[model samples]
Target: MTGAADAGAPLLEVRGVGKSYGSVSALRGVTASVAAGEVLCVLGDNGAGKSTLIKILAGAHAPTEGTLLAHGVERQFASPRDALALGIATVYQDLALVPLLPVWRNFFLGAEITVGRGPFRRLDVAAMRRATRDDLALMGITLRDVDQPIGTLSGGERQAVAIARAVHFGAGLVILDEPTSALGVSQAALVLRYIARARDRGIGIVFITHNPHHAWAVGDRFLVLRRGTSLGEFGRDEISLEALTGLMAGGAELDALGPELDRAASARDPA
Candidate 1:
């Protein structure tokens, strides 16, 4: 994947964005960007304002200050629908899926398509099934059958389905929130593979997670957030996995925790 320096302008840019509630500030001067076909990994620990940033991007909350630019144009998102209208899709960790529903049904959940005229209209089941299969295949995804309940699929497969649905709906940017948090090693790798696939297809990705290893696997750029502000942003060529992990751990803080963790391990040891 190309680095941020060569990916052209960002699909979405948040410049000096801040959020406040009365006298308390939740986020301060946070800046980041995600470009077309570029994966910008936002790395941070808890309370690092990651959620606040995502909420602002998803249009769930307005920024108290600063601007959000989409395609080089300044604008404020009125709602998630407004963002969606601009082709920004947010797939939360939960995935917003109906577990009991069949894969095809969940694929076309809200925006169901129908065949024939008004009075004779019927759910275009066959069309949706075929399209779903074809889209997944295009993204290197394969499902045993579109008729099975979505709950039967593994975590990674479900994430792929959500991604494919976003692509099929013409999303230019996809914001994924901690997509691999609950998955096993193999499952997490599967999702990361699809993330790379998404980037190769020219869809910008904002990957939010605390795991530096996962970020290093597919990120074109890295943005480290701490206590509501940005540590800084670096291109893939500019930062190493070791540096990223150190930054996320807050250097001296991680150093202090190391001995404590070792002692804790000793206390728990049977020997």
Candidate 2:
């Protein structure tokens, strides 16, 4: 949707990354990189290794082969906390929010700010409330009240809050796993707008989704995977929307669907 990234170094890079479980290969020799202010959309159908890729990037799993580089240096992330320490944040579709908690409370759920010292410390509720309000406002997300239960918000709004929270917590790379999958068309558009807002603020985004149209709407680069392997990765200029869709469905597979659909249409003709 925007111009290519500034040609700066990637904030995160995966070089020939692979993961395996016993004899089952979940990911094989996949490679991609995302620079600051860029959106790299990873598109694939089920069993395409997208989940494995997310776990590796989020440090939930370690790669059995190849390398992961952060800011051009090779490093291993032993846990999710290890990756978070380096400003890598992953926002799953469920959002990991407590539906019963107020927006402000949920905003600072695990990482609450505190006042006073030692045994006298107390939750800085007012500070968190204001921060939650103002920060979401800056991300173009205007909530009616920070006191409302987060579950009352629509799917898109909840995802926006998660994205804003990640950015506020100083995450440089935000990985969104199917953030728009459950939303209707209008709500999905709202989430896409939030994603663009994140990119404009100099955050690298790895947007993983099965919908090529959703990914195509905001992606600057595209990566396709099939059956646990990397089909290819292409820049925005190098790939078209049609080509992206075809590749995600597998070129030959979609071609086979065309004639069957044409025959189905003819069978329904009154003439």
Tens digits of per-residue lDDT for model 1, 3-104: 322235678999999899999998889888888999999899999999999999988889999999887777799898888877889999999899999999
Off-target runs (Cα >4 Å) in candidate 1 are 1-8, 268-271
Q: What is the C-alpha lDDT of each candidate?
A: 0.90, 0.91
* Cα lDDT of model 2 by residue, 73-183, tens digit: 676999988888778899998898999899999999999999999899999989999999998997798877899999998889999999999988989999999998889
- Where does model 2 exceed 4 Å of error? 1-8, 261-271
lDDT of 1 at 244: 91
Highest TM-score against the true fold, candidate: 1
TM-score of 1: 0.93
Per-prediction TM-score to the true structure, in the order listed: 0.93, 0.93
Candidate closest to the true structure, highest lDDT: 2
Candidate 2: 10-residue stretch with minimal lDDT: 1-10
Structure candidate 2, residue pairs in collision: none
